[model samples]
Target chain A: MAWNLQSDRPIYAQLVEQLRRMIVTGVYPAGSKLPAVRELAVEAAVNPNTMQRALVRLEEEGLLYAQRTSGRYVTEDNEKIMEAKEAMAAELISGFVSDMMRLGYTREQTIRLLEKKREG
Target chain B: MEEYLISCRDLGKSFPGCRALNGINLELPRGRIIGLLGPNGSGKSTFLKLCNGLLTPDRGELLVCGSRPGVESKKHVSYLPERSYLNDWMTVEQMIGFFKDFYADFEEARAYDMLARLAVDPAKRMKTMSKGTKEKVQLILVMSRRAQLYLLDEPIGGVDPAARDFILSTIITNYNPEGSVVISTHLIADVENILDDVIFINSGNIVLCDSVENIRAKQDKSVDMLFREVFRC
Candidate 1:
């Protein structure tokens, strides 16, 4: 999938968000190897160091693991991936709620609208 | 011992009436893409020229690879000036040959590959190709060299958006982690995402130098927007 990034925010943060999406969406399936830092940086048209930082952040969150010599791989832990997906879903829902409220919709109205949209 | 690919200490340069640069202190490490950004007449080009030894600083010093800009430093620097330097009479292939003969680090195969990828006709004279195509050829030659410092001055200044993307990608894919690239341009938004760090210059002085990430974290805005705010007229 094409990585869409914005210049208005820190690229490292964007890289983390995009990579997380990729992981949870199974674009990079569990236990699959990630491209080397340099390779991904080139492909993403970002700094290698920034890309490294994003990967390191993911590793810290237990979404990825590094082998001594071979390189980084997506975590095989299914629960961790699910947790990431749930967190992303929560964030998206919160954003949606805020957007709806800004448009003058009450909380009940917003919920009703979402449920209607889901039904449709 | 060799920490910075390019460093400046009280570096200053001036013409008769205008000071092009003043009291510029900078330290650029290797393996990063740095954006040297400023408006017109902001000393961005002057700093780059000093790095390439095209012009010398009248006061203080600028060094590349721990040595002052000179023949020694020139060997490690691959520069792409804003103007086309290729002899219009020479064909693209011949131009590649000329670079190969002059630069020890120029990679013939890489140049050929880039040329092929750009779909540039090697047999066409430099004068015959469109402006965008000529720019692409020049970029290919410059990037083919495995130099320790790549100084590109307004590399995408006159190119179209498509060509700009190609040039940007070429730089990204061809960059050597053992070296550093300093790209000077006023078009900050177009090049913001690819840069590891950015150095803002204004009125012959170094203004702000920081990593792109740090700038965003602190300022909470894009580099281009921050540049607009900092250098607002």
Candidate 2:
């Protein structure tokens, strides 16, 4: 999938989030090699320096790790990936509940609506 | 010899009607893609022109690669002005040849490679090409140079969204790692993600200059949004 970055947030953060998603979703599978900085920047249409910063941040967070000679790679730690995925799902659900609340629906009503949609 | 790509001390410039730039002082580091942002009649173009040695400041010292804007400094800078300066009769191939012959740092293969990616035929003359194609050709020639600084004036102003992305990609991928680029344009959102730093100017004065991330982090606003709030008429 293409990077669908919003204009409101910091691009570096968006990139890090997107790359993390890519890894968590197995788009870049565990132990898979990530593209070079320039190539990634070209694909995302972002500055290489900005892309490098995002990659470095991801590396620090253990979602990615750098080899001495070869390029970066997705972390092989399945637990860490699972944790990230669960965290993302929690965030998505939280946002959905809050948005539904703003539209005058209680948490119970929101879940009921979800269950009804699934059943239908 | 210079510590910065371009440094100025109390730099100022003017035309017959009014001042274009006033007492601007800043230092641009290498390996950066800086957005020179401002509204119409702002000093963005004038600032870029000073860096390119096309316009001399009226009051203050301006340095490019440590020396004054002259023959030695010109060699280190590649400039793309807002208007086209290509010969109408020159075909795309011939234009590339002219650039290769004119600029010692120009890369023929890179220029051709960019043209190929854009599907621009080398046989098309400048006069026969669309406005967008002509702009792309100019951008290709400018980016093909292995110069120390690239001063681009509104490079994506007239291009389509697809072309704009291609041009921006070309810029980020092809620019020399050791050099700096200053892009002056009104399309803030289009270019914001690609910029490392941004210099916000208004009415001949520099209002802000900082890293793009810092702006978003500190102000909690996008550069485009902050720009509108800052430069609202």
Best by lDDT: 2
Residue pairs clashing, model 2: none
Each prediction's DockQ against the real complex: 0.71, 0.75
- lDDT (Cα, 0-100) at B82 in candidate 1: 79
Off by over 4 Å in 2: A100-118
Where does model 1 exceed 4 Å of error? A101-109, A118-120
How many residue-pair clashes does candidate 2 contain? 0
User: Candidate 1 at residue A24, lDDT?
Assistant: 100
Q: What is the lDDT of residue A106 in candidate 1?
A: 92
Report how far residue B148 has shifted in candidate 1, in Å: 0.9
For model 1, how does the per-residue alpha-carbon lDDT over B1-233 read when each residue is reduced to its tens digit?
A: 49998888899999999999988899999889999999999998888888878888899878798898888887899999978889999998899899999999999999998888778889999999888888888988999999888999989987788778878877777667788888999998888888989999999988898989999989889999999999889
For the second chain, the TM-scores of the candidates in order are 0.96, 0.97
In terms of lDDT, model 1 sits at 0.89
